[model samples]
Target: MAAKWQVVREMDANLIDTALVEAAYANPALRALFPLVSHGSLQFSRCTRFPWSQDLPSIFPYDGERHFRVRRLHEPRGSGREQIGGAVTADEAVELVASHLPPGCGPALDGTPDDLESLS
Candidate 1:
Protein backbone atom coordinates (compact mmCIF):
# COMPACT_ATOMS: atom_id res chain seq x y z
CA MET A 1 0.00 0.00 0.00
CA ALA A 2 1.14 3.55 -0.65
CA ALA A 3 1.91 5.74 2.33
CA LYS A 4 -0.43 8.65 3.21
CA TRP A 5 0.45 12.15 4.46
CA GLN A 6 -1.55 14.89 6.16
CA VAL A 7 -1.09 18.19 7.93
CA VAL A 8 -0.96 17.98 11.70
CA ARG A 9 -2.74 21.31 12.21
CA GLU A 10 -4.29 24.31 10.60
CA MET A 11 -1.65 26.67 9.25
CA ASP A 12 -2.24 30.35 9.78
CA ALA A 13 -1.69 32.41 6.68
CA ASN A 14 -0.44 35.31 8.77
CA LEU A 15 2.43 33.10 9.91
CA ILE A 16 2.73 30.61 7.09
CA ASP A 17 6.52 30.45 7.16
CA THR A 18 6.59 29.89 10.87
CA ALA A 19 3.75 27.39 10.66
CA LEU A 20 5.53 25.28 8.06
CA VAL A 21 8.76 25.20 10.04
CA GLU A 22 6.92 24.46 13.27
CA ALA A 23 4.91 21.63 11.73
CA ALA A 24 8.09 19.96 10.53
CA TYR A 25 9.75 20.49 13.87
CA ALA A 26 6.77 19.12 15.73
CA ASN A 27 6.76 16.00 13.54
CA PRO A 28 10.41 15.34 13.04
CA ALA A 29 9.95 11.78 11.83
CA LEU A 30 7.44 12.68 9.14
CA ARG A 31 9.46 15.77 8.28
CA ALA A 32 12.14 13.74 6.60
CA LEU A 33 9.52 11.69 4.78
CA PHE A 34 8.30 14.71 2.88
CA PRO A 35 10.50 17.60 1.86
CA LEU A 36 9.28 21.19 1.79
CA VAL A 37 10.67 23.81 -0.54
CA SER A 38 9.88 27.53 -0.36
CA HIS A 39 10.53 29.80 -3.30
CA GLY A 40 9.68 33.45 -2.85
CA SER A 41 5.99 33.53 -2.00
CA LEU A 42 5.41 29.94 -3.06
CA GLN A 43 5.92 26.86 -0.92
CA PHE A 44 5.88 23.24 -2.06
CA SER A 45 5.45 20.23 0.22
CA ARG A 46 5.86 16.92 -1.59
CA CYS A 47 4.36 13.75 -0.12
CA THR A 48 4.14 11.25 -2.98
CA ARG A 49 6.71 9.35 -5.01
CA PHE A 50 6.74 9.45 -8.77
CA PRO A 51 8.56 7.79 -11.62
CA TRP A 52 11.78 9.38 -12.78
CA SER A 53 9.99 11.06 -15.65
CA GLN A 54 6.82 12.06 -13.78
CA ASP A 55 5.90 14.60 -11.13
CA LEU A 56 5.39 14.06 -7.43
CA PRO A 57 2.38 15.02 -5.33
CA SER A 58 2.78 18.49 -3.84
CA ILE A 59 0.75 21.20 -2.09
CA PHE A 60 1.05 24.96 -2.08
CA PRO A 61 -0.80 28.03 -0.87
CA TYR A 62 -3.18 29.76 -3.25
CA ASP A 63 -4.59 33.32 -3.38
CA GLY A 64 -4.08 35.85 -0.62
CA GLU A 65 -6.26 33.84 1.74
CA ARG A 66 -3.65 31.07 1.94
CA HIS A 67 -6.07 28.45 0.71
CA PHE A 68 -4.29 25.15 0.24
CA ARG A 69 -3.82 23.95 -3.34
CA VAL A 70 -2.52 20.60 -4.57
CA ARG A 71 -0.80 19.79 -7.83
CA ARG A 72 1.93 17.76 -9.49
CA LEU A 73 5.08 19.50 -10.62
CA HIS A 74 6.12 18.38 -14.11
CA GLU A 75 9.25 20.56 -13.91
CA PRO A 76 10.96 21.28 -17.22
CA ARG A 77 8.16 19.87 -19.31
CA GLY A 78 5.61 21.83 -17.23
CA SER A 79 2.74 20.39 -19.20
CA GLY A 80 1.03 18.21 -16.63
CA ARG A 81 0.56 20.71 -13.81
CA GLU A 82 -3.07 20.67 -12.72
CA GLN A 83 -5.01 21.88 -9.69
CA ILE A 84 -6.18 18.87 -7.73
CA GLY A 85 -8.10 20.61 -4.93
CA GLY A 86 -8.40 23.67 -2.72
CA ALA A 87 -9.35 24.14 0.89
CA VAL A 88 -9.72 27.00 3.31
CA THR A 89 -7.81 25.24 6.06
CA ALA A 90 -4.53 23.37 6.10
CA ASP A 91 -6.08 20.36 7.80
CA GLU A 92 -8.73 20.07 5.10
CA ALA A 93 -6.08 20.56 2.46
CA VAL A 94 -4.09 17.61 3.74
CA GLU A 95 -7.21 15.47 3.75
CA LEU A 96 -7.69 16.24 0.09
CA VAL A 97 -4.04 15.57 -0.62
CA ALA A 98 -4.22 12.30 1.29
CA SER A 99 -6.85 10.95 -1.07
CA HIS A 100 -4.47 11.33 -4.01
CA LEU A 101 -1.27 10.17 -2.30
CA PRO A 102 0.22 6.80 -3.10
CA PRO A 103 -0.03 4.05 -0.49
CA GLY A 104 2.45 4.01 2.45
CA CYS A 105 3.14 7.70 2.41
CA GLY A 106 2.24 7.94 6.11
CA PRO A 107 -1.11 8.85 7.77
CA ALA A 108 -3.99 11.27 7.33
CA LEU A 109 -4.38 14.24 9.68
CA ASP A 110 -8.12 14.43 9.48
CA GLY A 111 -8.47 15.45 13.12
CA THR A 112 -9.23 11.87 14.02
CA PRO A 113 -7.76 9.54 16.64
CA ASP A 114 -5.85 7.71 13.91
CA ASP A 115 -3.91 10.89 13.31
CA LEU A 116 -1.97 10.20 16.49
CA GLU A 117 -0.31 7.19 14.88
CA SER A 118 1.53 9.35 12.39
CA LEU A 119 3.14 11.41 15.15
CA SER A 120 4.23 8.38 17.09
Candidate 2:
Protein backbone atom coordinates (compact mmCIF):
# COMPACT_ATOMS: atom_id res chain seq x y z
CA MET A 1 0.00 0.00 0.00
CA ALA A 2 1.12 3.59 -0.56
CA ALA A 3 2.53 5.24 2.52
CA LYS A 4 0.07 7.71 3.95
CA TRP A 5 2.13 10.89 4.00
CA GLN A 6 1.67 14.63 4.24
CA VAL A 7 3.88 17.70 3.69
CA VAL A 8 3.14 20.84 5.65
CA ARG A 9 4.60 24.32 5.73
CA GLU A 10 3.56 27.92 6.35
CA MET A 11 3.52 30.99 4.09
CA ASP A 12 1.32 33.78 2.87
CA ALA A 13 -2.11 32.48 1.85
CA ASN A 14 -2.35 34.65 -1.24
CA LEU A 15 1.17 33.81 -2.29
CA ILE A 16 0.60 30.09 -1.97
CA ASP A 17 -2.72 30.23 -3.83
CA THR A 18 -1.21 32.20 -6.69
CA ALA A 19 1.76 29.89 -6.86
CA LEU A 20 -0.42 26.79 -6.94
CA VAL A 21 -2.63 28.23 -9.68
CA GLU A 22 0.33 29.42 -11.71
CA ALA A 23 2.09 26.09 -11.31
CA ALA A 24 -0.98 24.18 -12.41
CA TYR A 25 -1.34 26.39 -15.45
CA ALA A 26 2.32 25.96 -16.34
CA ASN A 27 2.28 22.20 -15.85
CA PRO A 28 -0.83 20.33 -16.85
CA ALA A 29 0.22 17.35 -14.78
CA LEU A 30 -0.12 19.45 -11.66
CA ARG A 31 -3.73 20.03 -12.57
CA ALA A 32 -4.27 16.37 -11.89
CA LEU A 33 -2.23 16.54 -8.73
CA PHE A 34 -4.10 19.58 -7.49
CA PRO A 35 -7.52 19.80 -9.07
CA LEU A 36 -9.13 22.04 -6.48
CA VAL A 37 -7.84 25.28 -5.03
CA SER A 38 -9.55 27.26 -2.31
CA HIS A 39 -8.69 30.22 -0.13
CA GLY A 40 -10.05 31.80 3.06
CA SER A 41 -9.15 34.72 5.24
CA LEU A 42 -6.70 32.64 7.27
CA GLN A 43 -5.65 29.80 5.02
CA PHE A 44 -5.35 28.46 1.47
CA SER A 45 -5.68 24.89 0.27
CA ARG A 46 -5.00 22.79 -2.83
CA CYS A 47 -6.45 19.33 -3.08
CA THR A 48 -6.82 16.35 -5.45
CA ARG A 49 -8.75 13.14 -5.35
CA PHE A 50 -6.88 9.88 -4.83
CA PRO A 51 -8.00 6.46 -5.93
CA TRP A 52 -6.71 4.61 -2.88
CA SER A 53 -8.79 6.56 -0.45
CA GLN A 54 -11.84 8.76 -0.37
CA ASP A 55 -9.98 11.54 1.40
CA LEU A 56 -8.02 13.63 -1.06
CA PRO A 57 -4.48 14.93 -0.69
CA SER A 58 -4.59 18.43 0.69
CA ILE A 59 -2.03 21.21 1.00
CA PHE A 60 -2.67 24.09 3.33
CA PRO A 61 -0.78 27.33 3.81
CA TYR A 62 -1.15 29.36 6.97
CA ASP A 63 -0.96 33.12 6.99
CA GLY A 64 2.40 34.82 7.53
CA GLU A 65 4.75 37.30 5.92
CA ARG A 66 8.42 36.38 6.28
CA HIS A 67 7.90 33.02 7.91
CA PHE A 68 4.80 30.80 7.89
CA ARG A 69 3.52 27.27 8.44
CA VAL A 70 2.06 24.96 5.80
CA ARG A 71 0.58 21.53 6.37
CA ARG A 72 -0.21 18.48 4.25
CA LEU A 73 -3.28 16.53 5.33
CA HIS A 74 -3.07 12.77 5.31
CA GLU A 75 -5.51 10.03 6.12
CA PRO A 76 -3.55 7.28 7.83
CA ARG A 77 -6.43 5.21 9.11
CA GLY A 78 -7.81 8.51 10.29
CA SER A 79 -7.21 12.21 9.73
CA GLY A 80 -3.53 13.04 10.28
CA ARG A 81 -1.22 15.96 9.61
CA GLU A 82 2.49 16.45 9.05
CA GLN A 83 4.99 19.24 8.70
CA ILE A 84 7.24 18.73 5.70
CA GLY A 85 8.90 22.12 5.23
CA GLY A 86 8.70 25.87 5.49
CA ALA A 87 9.40 28.80 3.15
CA VAL A 88 10.29 32.46 3.26
CA THR A 89 8.98 33.18 -0.23
CA ALA A 90 6.12 32.02 -2.37
CA ASP A 91 8.53 30.38 -4.82
CA GLU A 92 10.09 28.37 -2.04
CA ALA A 93 6.69 27.30 -0.76
CA VAL A 94 5.70 26.18 -4.24
CA GLU A 95 8.91 24.19 -4.59
CA LEU A 96 8.22 22.48 -1.28
CA VAL A 97 4.73 21.58 -2.45
CA ALA A 98 6.07 20.13 -5.70
CA SER A 99 8.76 18.14 -3.94
CA HIS A 100 6.35 16.57 -1.47
CA LEU A 101 3.67 15.46 -3.94
CA PRO A 102 2.40 11.90 -3.31
CA PRO A 103 4.25 9.01 -4.91
CA GLY A 104 3.69 8.65 -8.68
CA CYS A 105 2.96 12.33 -8.98
CA GLY A 106 6.02 13.75 -10.75
CA PRO A 107 7.84 17.00 -10.41
CA ALA A 108 6.33 20.34 -11.42
CA LEU A 109 8.21 23.32 -12.81
CA ASP A 110 6.63 26.72 -13.25
CA GLY A 111 9.39 28.69 -14.91
CA THR A 112 11.13 28.98 -18.27
CA PRO A 113 14.22 27.01 -19.26
CA ASP A 114 16.47 29.88 -18.39
CA ASP A 115 14.83 30.32 -15.02
CA LEU A 116 15.06 26.61 -14.25
CA GLU A 117 18.62 26.41 -15.51
CA SER A 118 19.66 29.21 -13.21
CA LEU A 119 18.41 27.22 -10.21
CA SER A 120 20.51 24.24 -11.25
Would you list the clashing residue pairs of candidate 1? 1-103, 2-102, 2-103, 2-104, 3-103, 3-104, 3-105, 3-106, 4-105, 4-106
Model 2 ranges off by over 4 Å: 1-16, 27-29, 41-57, 64-68, 106-120
TM-score of 2: 0.44
Over all chains combined, what TM-score does candidate 1 have? Answer: 0.46
lDDT of 1 by residue, 1-120 (tens): 012223322334454544543443344333434443444122223223331222344567676565667676556337777777765455555545555554554432333223333654
Total clashes in model 2, counting residue pairs 3 or more apart in sequence or in different chains = 9
- lDDT by residue (2-43, candidate 2, tens digit) is 111112123344434545444433434344342443452112
TM-score of each: 0.46, 0.44
lDDT of 2 at 44: 22
Judge candidate 1 against the unseen true structure and give its global Cα lDDT, from 0 to 1. 0.44
In order, candidate lDDTs are 0.44, 0.40
Off by over 4 Å in 1: 1-16, 20-32, 40-54, 73-78, 106-120
Best by lDDT: 1
C-alpha lDDT (0 to 100) for residue 5 of candidate 1: 22
